[model samples]
Target: MNPVSVTDYRQLAKKRLPHFLFEYIDGGSYAETTLGRNMADLERVALRQRVLTDVSSLDLSVELFGQSLSMPVALAPIGLAGMNARRGEVQAARAAAVAGVPFCLSTVSACSLDEVARSTAKPFWFQLYMIRDRAFMRDLLGSARRLGCSALVLTADMPVPGSRYRDYRSGLAGAPGLRGNLRRVAQSVCRPGWAWDVGINGRPHQLGNVAPILGNNSGMDDFFAWMRDNFDPGVTWKDIDFVRGEWGGPLIVKGILDPEDARSAVAEGVDGIVVSNHGGRQLDGVLSSVKALPPIVDAVGDKATVLVDGGVRSGLDVVRMLALGAQGVLLGRAWAYALGARGEAGVTHMLKIIAAEIAVAMALTGCRNIEAIDRDILAELGQDINSRL
Candidate 1:
């Protein structure tokens, strides 16, 4: 496949990657209702077609947290991202830099923040999971600060990792000991491309951020074990101040689905709030990010920077998110699939595909610029647009 669309890239990724790796990026929590809703809802969102409007001179640019973006899209922080390709996060960061957008590196990414910073001088964002070890958290924060990271994204959800049935079935999680190892080996062998590209060649397979603490236990087992042991479930809003004190940069709180929580994030003075359900991976029964967006926008659009993620599969979907009132949209699975399928070149092309889609969508909607994107561009506002299309 030439992979002209993100969906095409996803198909390519499925063929090229091992089953466990594909499942890791593609699957959601138990039932995955929210995940389905995330995509279905966005697809049903109709864009109002306007005729004879002067959209010839279009500008898709937008500025967030003092950083300029070619479009309102960022490569979201995804764990084990590097395993998808050789130094996947670094490659994605380079693509983002060239595309003039932000790439947020997950703390559990295959490549560390230092590695990405070294590879690309373009400032990237670092995402932090609340770890039980506050000292280690401080070290990570200090590293971000010292590396001149443009922003710090603190994921507020996922204190307790969600129960993903797909991970267990695919042997990425739960299945352990010799049998699990054999299963993963067998799966990797089935996809020889992945085995050679990542398995044999992608050395030191350690989850980079915590590699220091992992010591000799630096493998897939330690990656999951460390997350299981260190994830802090008892976190509250006030705990953010500890992070606020440690770092001085644009602090964005991701995974806010409720307006009350969005309001609370505003009360805590976060620079931005990513209206997300962790891409429907964390909580399965909650509202989709788009479904949760309008209310949250009503609650804090004026107060905080509102960005959204989940089921943003296309550039039309990007415009849909912006129309629903997100200043930006984050690409999690979209970029992950692209990287797995084609490496840096795949990422670069995926972005071009999205940019083209956004431009076309904007031109059709008669939106010449980002500021013109509002509820008005929606085809029909109150016609019960929530049903699955």
Candidate 2:
């Protein structure tokens, strides 16, 4: 069957990838309560449709960080994306360029920053994780600057990695023992297509960004260990000053849920703030990004561009976020699912689906342009959801 929605891509990805890798992308931390809430709360938002409105010329274009985007959507950074397909990050970057959207590459991605830069002429964004090594961090910042990255997304939520039960069960965590190795080998043997396309043909399986720091022969186990040892637990707002000193381009601080943090980010001089909960992969019981968005928007929307990411699956969901006062929305698992399912073609297809959906939704809601979307376009289902926020 042909895939039509992001969820359809997810299903296809599950079938094509090894079980452990699929769960790593699909599962959330702990009981995944916040993960489930992200979508559930978005579904609760109802759009106020109107008839007899002139919707002849629909404009979905949005200007962000001095760049014109075809739509108010971007593909979020996902680590180990190369494991999904043959040089998956490069493929996804090319797709994002074709779709005229920013593609943020993770510091832990399978393709190096230079490799992706050489693959596409479009200026992509880079997501940074504040590691313990100051020298390595500086080197990464220099590389991004040299590569002409349009933006630097500093993730602040994961001071420490969340305890994902699925990772443990799938043997992604814990020591790499003989049994776990055998189990992974057996799983790879079963998924011959994945093994051939990504495992065998997609050589240089090491984390491209950190391979120099951990040596050229480093593998998944070494990457995990490096993460455990390097992710600084005592990161403070002062680190923002350090990053600002290094990166002169557009700076975005991701993983913000609280209004206070949003305020602090503005004071720290970030150009944009992503009101996210790490897609519920980080704190499981925290408020969903949708629920947390309004306050943050009210707090810092004027000072900095407010973007959101969490459980945003369809074009209508993007509309909901825009109506709630977000400048744009970042999609994490959606594009990853597409890339895993059908590589570059799947990503391009997914973007077309979402763009078409957004246009249709805007027309149905009496919005002739994206800038006209506001809270007035929303109606309470039964209770005052805005009051709750």
Candidate 3:
């Protein structure tokens, strides 16, 4: 398959990856109600069409955090990206640099910060998860600064990991001990292409970022055990103060979905807030990011940059988010699917498809640029909300 759309890339990824790894990337929390709703609610948004508008000169560029972006989209952080392809984070960072957009590296990434920084000329953003080890967190911040990271994204969602049943059922969580490990190996045997490309050729299969702390020879089960032991569940607002004091650069609080939390984030002096539900991987029944965006935008006003992620599949979905009051959109599974399907080339193709789609959507909607996209482009916000209910 040529794979023109993100969905096509996803199908390709499913076929190329082992069953356990594929389910880990594609599945969500228990019941997956919010996961399904994120995309469904985005489809519910109606776009207004107009003709005879002069859109001959279209600019997809936008300024984010004092940096000019070729488009108002960034790749969201995803763990175990290296498992998808050999040195996947490095490949994804290069793709983002070529596309002229930001790529946020996950704390649990397969590649180290220094490796990615050395590979790309453009400085990329780093995403942090506040674990129980305060000294380690502080040192990680120092490392990010020394590497010249453009921004620090503090993901406030997963104080504890969500209950993803798919992970358990697929033997991804190493639940059934030796039996599960044997099952995973058997599944890998079925997909010899993936086994050779990722399992054999993708050497250094451990989590690179935490290798120094958790040993370089650690495996997926060891990383999971470390996360289970160290993820701090007692974090509070004061922890934000600690992060602010340590990192002097732009700090974005991810996983914010409530207007009250948005107000508190402004009060806490965050540079930006991502209206996300951890891409519906954390919470199960919460409102979709789009439905949760308007009130948060109303609450924060211009005090902070309000970006969004979750169920953003295409450029039109990006337009719908901008119309609903998001300054930018972060793509999670979309880019991951592409990366797993065709490595860096697949990622570059996916970005081009989205950019072209956004241009066409902007031309048809009578909007000349991203700034012209507002709530008015959406057909009756009240009716759309009612329909979702």
Candidate 4:
């Protein structure tokens, strides 16, 4: 099929990936109420069409964290991406660099910080997970600095891994060697191209950032056990202060959905905050990140850059998020699924499609720059808070 949108890439990913791995990327927590709502709430937002406006030359560029972005979009940190494709993190980073955007590498990624940075000329961002040991966290930050990372994204969610019934049912958490091998073989038979390239020719994946502290988890259950024991639930704002003091660079707090928390991050001096629910993987019944964006944007009062992730699948959804006051949007599963489907080329295509859509949307909405998008668009949609979110 000819892919023209992120959803088309998702269909390709579903066809290429093993069922268990596909479910891991596609499924959410519990009943997935929050997952579905994320996209639905964004769809509820209405855009105003203008008949007379000179948008002949549109500029989607924006200055974020002292970096001039070609467009107001960044790739969110996604875990276990290497399992989706061989050296997937590096592939995705290269794609982001080609598209002129920042790609945040997750702490749990199969590729190392140095590896991803070496793969791209652009300064990629690094996402950190505050483990139970402060010394380890310090070492991780030092490693990122050594790799010349431009930003530190502290993921505050996942103190404990959320319950995913699909993984449990598929036995993905146990019997890693035999079960995983068999599953891959079967999936490769289904998608010969992906199998020959990723499954056969790909190198053995390792978690580059954490390989020193913890070995590559051979079994899913082993990984879950290690994570449950090591993750620090007692992490507090003081931890953020310590990281900021150590890094001395742009520090972005992710997984924030509350207005008070956003305000606190600003007062405590964070450079940015991403309004996300861990892509609906951490919490089940919480409000969608889009629903939480308005209040958080209001609370920050322009003190820090505000970005959001979760259910941002299309260019129109990006428009809705910007209209709701988000400074930018994060592409989570969008790029990951694309990489799984067609390696680097698929991701590059996905980025271009979204960019063109944003430009067209801006032209139709009577807005020239991203900053011109405001709450006024909501009035034209006849949308109320209760009705939309």
Q: How would you order the candidates by TM-score, starting with the best?
A: 1, 2, 3, 4
lDDT of 4 by residue, 223-314 (tens): 66767888988989888878986798899999898998998899889999999998888889999988899889888987999999999998
TM-score of model 3 (CA atoms) = 0.97
Please, what's the RMSD in Å of model 3? Answer: 1.4
Question: How would you order the candidates by lDDT, starting with the best?
Answer: 1, 2, 3, 4
Instruction: Write model 1 residue lDDT over 1-389, tens digit each, in one string.
Output: 88889999999999999999999999999999999999988888888899899988999999999998898999999999999998889999999999999999999999998899999989999999999999999999999999999999999999999999999999988877788889999999999988998899987698889988998897677788888998999999989899999988999999999889999999999999999999889989999888889889989968889999999999999999999889999999999999999999999999999999999999999999999999898877875334422
lDDT of each: 0.92, 0.91, 0.90, 0.84
**TM-score: the better of candidates 3 and 4:** 3
Candidate 2 lDDT tens digits, 250-335? 99999999999999999988999999999889899999999999878989958999999999999999999999889999999999
TM-score (all chains, Cα) for each model: 0.98, 0.98, 0.97, 0.95
Worst 10 residues of 1 by lDDT: 380-389
Candidate 1 — what's its lDDT? 0.92
Q: Candidate 2 — worst ten consecutive residues by lDDT sum?
A: 380-389
**Which runs of model 2 end up more than 4 angstroms from their true locations?**
381-384, 387-389
Count of clashes, each model: 0, 0, 0, 1
Model 1 has a clash total of: 0
Which residue pairs show backbone clashes in model 1?
none
